[model samples]
Target: MQIVIAEDSVLLRAGLTGLLADAGHDVVAAVGDADALIEVVERHRPDLCVTDVRMPPTHTDDGLRAARQIRERWPEVGILVLSQYVEERYATELLATDTTGLGYLLKDRIADVADFVAAVDRVGSGGTALDPEVVSQLLARSRRRDPLERLSPREREVLGLMAEGRTNTAIARQLVVSDGAVEKHISNIFTKLDLPPTDGDHRRVLAVLRWLEGLEP
Candidate 1:
C-alpha cells in the first residue's frame, strides 16, 4: 500500500515512515505540516494518509481539519489520524460524516508496532480501525446526549412496558400504580419524547419505537 504521513514532529514522522517502509508499504511522501500534507496528498494521491491531529500553522487541529477536507475531496484516500489525545469534537464530526476508510488511534495506544501496521493496512483497504478508547469515548458521548436520558426512572419503566405491548391498565398493574397514574406517566413520556399527537395509537407506537431505538447496540 502507498502511504503519506503528516506529522509536526520530525522524529515521529520519520519513525512512521520507517515503520511503514519496513512493513512492505511505500511511503510516498512525508510532510511536517497540514498545508504540505494536503499538497503532497494531491500530488501523490496515496492509498492512505497517516496524520497527526495537531500540526504546523497554529498547531490546534490543522491536521484533523485537513484530513476532513481530504476525505471530502478524495474519499478514496483513506485517513488514519494519530493523536496525542482524543479531540472528541473533530473526531466525532469526521466519523459522523463517514466511517469507511477511516481510523483514529491515540499515539500512546500504539504500543505494538505490528498492531499499528495492521491498523494502517486495514484502514487503507477501506476498513475501520478505531482505538478502543476512541470507541468508548464515542459511546459515552452518545449516551450523554441520548434522548432517553431525559426520562425519569419511572418514565423509563413505563416506556419499557409500553414497548412490550402493554396497555395502560396492564402497565399500571405491573407497576402497582393506578390506571390514572399510568395515564399521567404516559402523557409525560409523550411530552418529554416530543411525540406529536397526530393519532393516539400512532403516537403510542412512535413512543415505543423511540424507546426501542434507545435499546439498540
Candidate 2:
C-alpha cells in the first residue's frame, strides 16, 4: 500500500518509513509537522497516514488534530495514530465516530515489527486496530453497576478483545478456546448487551462501541 508518515522526530519518522517500505509498502511522503502532513496527504493522497500524537507548530495534539481533519476531508484515507502513553481521552475522542480504517497504537508497539506491520495492514484495509492497552485502561476504569454488569467475566474478556480489534480466531488463540466456543461467547455477549445482529463484523464494532459507551458516566 502507498503511505505517508507524520512525525516530528527525524529518526522515528525515518525508521517508520524504512520499516513500512521493507514490509513491501510504498512510502510516498514523510514529513515533520502537522501542516506538512496535511499538505503531503492532500498532494499524494496515500493509502494510509501513520502519525505521532504530538507534532510541530504547537507540540501538543497537532498531529491528532490534523488526523481528525484528514478524516473529515478525505475519509477514504486510513489513519493510524501513535501515542507515547495510553491517553484514554484521546482514545475515546478518536474512536467516538466512524471506526473504519482507524487505528490508535502506542509508540512502543513499533518495537514489535511484525505486530506493528500487521496493524498497519489492518487499518490500511479499512479495519480497526486499537491498542490492547487502550482497551485495558478503559476496562479498568469502568464504573460499577453499569450495563456491563450483565456480562460474565469470560464474556467481558471476549468483549475487551473485541474492542482491541481481534478477530474471532485471534481471540480464541489468546484465550486458548475453540473458535466455536469463542463464537458462542460472542453471541452471548451481544445478546446480553442488547445489540441486534447485523453483519458479523459490524456487530462486533457496535458491541465494542457499546462497551466503550458503558464506560462513560
Cα lDDT tens digits, model 2, 1-217, are 9999999999999999999999999999999999999999999998999999889999988998999999999999999999999877777788887999999999999999999999999999999999999888867756434667899999999999999999999999999999999999999998887787665557777889988997788
Residue by residue across 138-167, what tens digits does model 1's lDDT show? 889877787888899999999999999999
* Candidate-wise lDDT, in order: 0.92, 0.92
Model 2, 125: alpha-carbon shift in Å?
A: 0.4
Q: Give the local distance difference test score of model 1.
A: 0.92
Q: How much is 22 displaced in model 2, in angstroms?
A: 0.4
Error of 2 at 207 (Å): 28
Record all residue pairs in model 2 with backbone atoms less than 3 Å apart, i.e. clashing: none
RMSD of 1: 10.4
Off by over 4 Å in 1: 146-217
Output the TM-score of candidate 2.
Answer: 0.66
